[model samples]
Target chain A: MSESAKRQSALGRMMLDEAFEARVRSEPARVAEELSLPLSFVLELAAISAERVRAFRASQRHKDAVRGGKPPTKLRW
Target chain B: MPRASVGIGLRDAYVEPLRDLRDRRALDVLEVMIDDAQFDRRRMDAWRSLGQRWPLVAHGVALGPGDAIGLDREYVRAVSADLAAVGARWYSDHLCFLRVAGERGPIDLGHFAPLALDDGDLAVLRDNAAALREQYAGTFLLENPADILGFAGQGDAHGRESGRRYTAALRACAAGALLDVTNLALQARNDGFSAGVFLDELDWDRVVEVHLAGGRRSGGLWIDSHDHPVDEEAWALLEHVARRADNLRAVIIERDDRLPTLEVLLDEVAHARRLLP
Candidate 1:
């Protein structure tokens, strides 16, 4: 994969997977090495405050609940 | 120039209420979700009826134009057909990637994902926007995604400058912008930048529509929850932009969850109409 794609993939995982995010939050350098991401990019991820991440996750969960655990199938008028 | 029209996003729960608003001359337009109109015949007919009554604008949630792999051609064709069916004045989708290539195939992220804002992503957006405009045979627009989680390479000054250049680039390719003022306010609040300065730097000539919504503060950041009423900060920013955006055409009050009475949203719409010069 290209460098940019790799970064996107890693970030996507972090956003979608709670366990992965936790792992990254606790051991960002190790995770970066395993994912072959640049140290600079990993540092950026590290800088994202835990509170912000929690807020984002909470919002996502709320959205899921609003959708009733199903992907958007129709317009909710 | 004509005054910008005010509208509300049509949702399932607001059908009768919207009809009432239309009869009362409180609504100027309706923004329909293209995805909802595509797969359901009954919904399409309802949207068509609403379109006949009020000017319709098409908006989509899942057209990830920023994907480097390119847009889904079949989906684009379907979207174009839906837009035609509804007689939409314009079409828009978020300028972010919702689907990404996965080992199995393509995976839907179920929400907007911020783009990298690099040359490659811009090229993707330009190409996709061009293709969409050609297929739809109408004006295409891209809404600014609410970047809650700061993406890499999007530092404050550099990111704002890159966004300006990218907006200009998209405009050059015939795609206008749908500026979500609420998202801008949230980003400014979270990132500690002056929203007014960012608006001043933007290529407003390319902005054809504006979205106003309400959000709540949570976990140290303001989330674009779209459940509450239009907040003061967003309304202030809307007022600021309304005075300056020369080519602005429409302003939509978007509410997706915790919908209040239709009268409440129409009141907000009236406030938006008052802001237009």
Candidate 2:
């Protein structure tokens, strides 16, 4: 991601975008049904995927801060 | 006898140092972080074997207030069983929510306030409290969390202001406060708020315990991940709070990430001990 583009990643501060959260909620079932993956595997994947996203945002924000950049503003609910 | 002045926040990482602290009389008390799997009879027996017979308060990371769904009954059951196993007096968890819907986070891994604070928030807690009451025979306490990005929706007062409101609400409920000074500083730095302001609003009368830790500022905002030395600001804050709260029970220094020597933590404990009332 571009550095400035990366700066928009708020520091683990994503409000449960009601819509986005709903999307994440349904992802495991969809992966299970479409990819023929085990439900447990899909659930684990979903969790790991979500954690990676949080970690990624966290890293991106950390980089921005280290380079003397202002962090992203808190997202309004 | 009255409680001691300063204490340390406990975690799995510090089990050895905790033993050392008890052995050397370094800490006044230690706040054991409540993990369901960590506290069993065998473990408690082993703890006793190691002479960890000092005063302790159990704190938790799984109190899922603010969830639309009710609390995770299994987790609550574990907490009760754990407290009974350890004979802990007061118990605490973050002032924010953990899981949501039913999926269990995005497993925020005990990150605080991903969800907004509302009446629903307190309701979920009250439900958990009722469940806790049914399972265990002790009172509950709460620790303020550091979420730089405050929940900016309905009734969204976080940081020290939120902590003040929390202090007010928990006071009304006749509960105890587990103030994490490091978190207060992390919140101040990240949220563009004032730690002093938060403390000024705090009802010291309700504070029963305090937690101190060093946070990593890697993520623009600070992480409450207990590592590094107790920063100067947090230590100063802890001393100020310790002096003001007459009912303050124990102060706990927390270390989670950067594994320092026991000597380093012992020194930090000494810093805390010097300020003890």
Candidate 3:
């Protein structure tokens, strides 16, 4: 994959996966190297607060549920 | 310029309430999500009927204009048909990418993803916005996403520089801005920038509409949940922009989740109407 695609995929993962987001928060450089993303992008991902990640993840889940015709999980504020 | 009209986003949960508001002449316009009615003929007919009573504006959620993979021509055509069916006044969509190219096909992120804000992304956005504008043949507005997660690129750490760059990008594309005040407030609180400074950096004339909504605090960060009442900070930003944006034509109260009673939204609409020049 190209560098841009790599970065976008990593971002996509960060939005979809809780564990991956935690790993990015704790070890940004390693994740950056693993994904071939710029360290700067990883650092930015690291700076994202855990609450924001959870909210984004919940939103994605809600959208998925809606598409599947399932009831959405209530998001905890 | 005419005084900006105040309105509310169209929600299925509030259709009856909106009809009452329209009858009472309390609502000015209705911003409908084109995607919601695109696939359902019944829903499209409902929106078309609503359009006969109130002027409708088209807002899309899944266009992903900033996506590098390129525009979804099929989705664009569908949205265009829906817009025409409802006689929409203008069209608007978020300036962030919602889809990415996957090996199988395009993957929908299901949420707005912040752009890298580099030259390459700007070029993609410019080309897409121009194409969409030409296709719509009417006012096309790009809304700033509520960027909770900051991206590392050609901008200052506090997000002011990013705001400036966004304004310049909109100007270059010759598309108007649907300046969402709630998004701006969320970015300021989450990214640690002066919201006033960010507002000042925008080219006021290009800002055609303003979105006002409430958000909740999560993990010490303000999330654009749009489930609460319009916060004071966002209201202040709305007032500030209302005074400055001479070309501002509309202000919409956007409440997507946890919708309250119609009276509550009407109050917000009234408050926003009072702020207009």
Question: Which of the numbered candidates is closest to the native, going by highest DockQ?
Answer: 3
Give me the runs in candidate 3 sitting further than 4 Å from their true place. Answer: A1-3, A18-36, A46-51, A62-77, B20-24, B152-157
- Give lDDT tens digits, candidate 3, residues B1-277: 7888788888777777665664556878888878877545666776787887889888887888787777788888778877877889999988888766555666778778887767777777887776676567777888998776665322334566767877876875677999998988888867777777777678887999999888777656666777788988888888889888889888999887777898889888888888777
TM-score of chain A of 3: 0.75
- Checking candidate 1 for backbone clashes, the offending pairs are A76-B12, A77-B11, A77-B12, A77-B13
- TM-score attained by model 1: 0.89
- lDDT value for candidate 2? 0.58
Q: Rank the candidates by DockQ, best first.
A: 3, 1, 2
Tens digits of lDDT, candidate 2, B1-277: 3645455655445666666554556655666656633434455554343334567677766665433355666777776777777778778776765443212223332345443334544555566556656776676777777654443311224444565567655753356788888887876776566677778777777788788877776534467666578889987897788778898877777765566776677688788878777
Taking the candidates in order, what DockQ does each have?
Answer: 0.27, 0.05, 0.29
What's the true lDDT of residue B206 in model 3?
Answer: 93
Q: Write the per-residue lDDT of candidate 1 for residues B103-196, one digit (tens) a residue.
A: 5666666667777667766666778777777678888888877777765434467446636754754664568889899988887777766676
Error of 2 at B251 (Å): 0.4
Candidate 1 residues lying further than 4 Å off, grouped into runs, are A25-36, A65-77, B21-24, B152-159, B162-173
Candidate-wise lDDT, in order: 0.76, 0.58, 0.77
Best by lDDT: 3
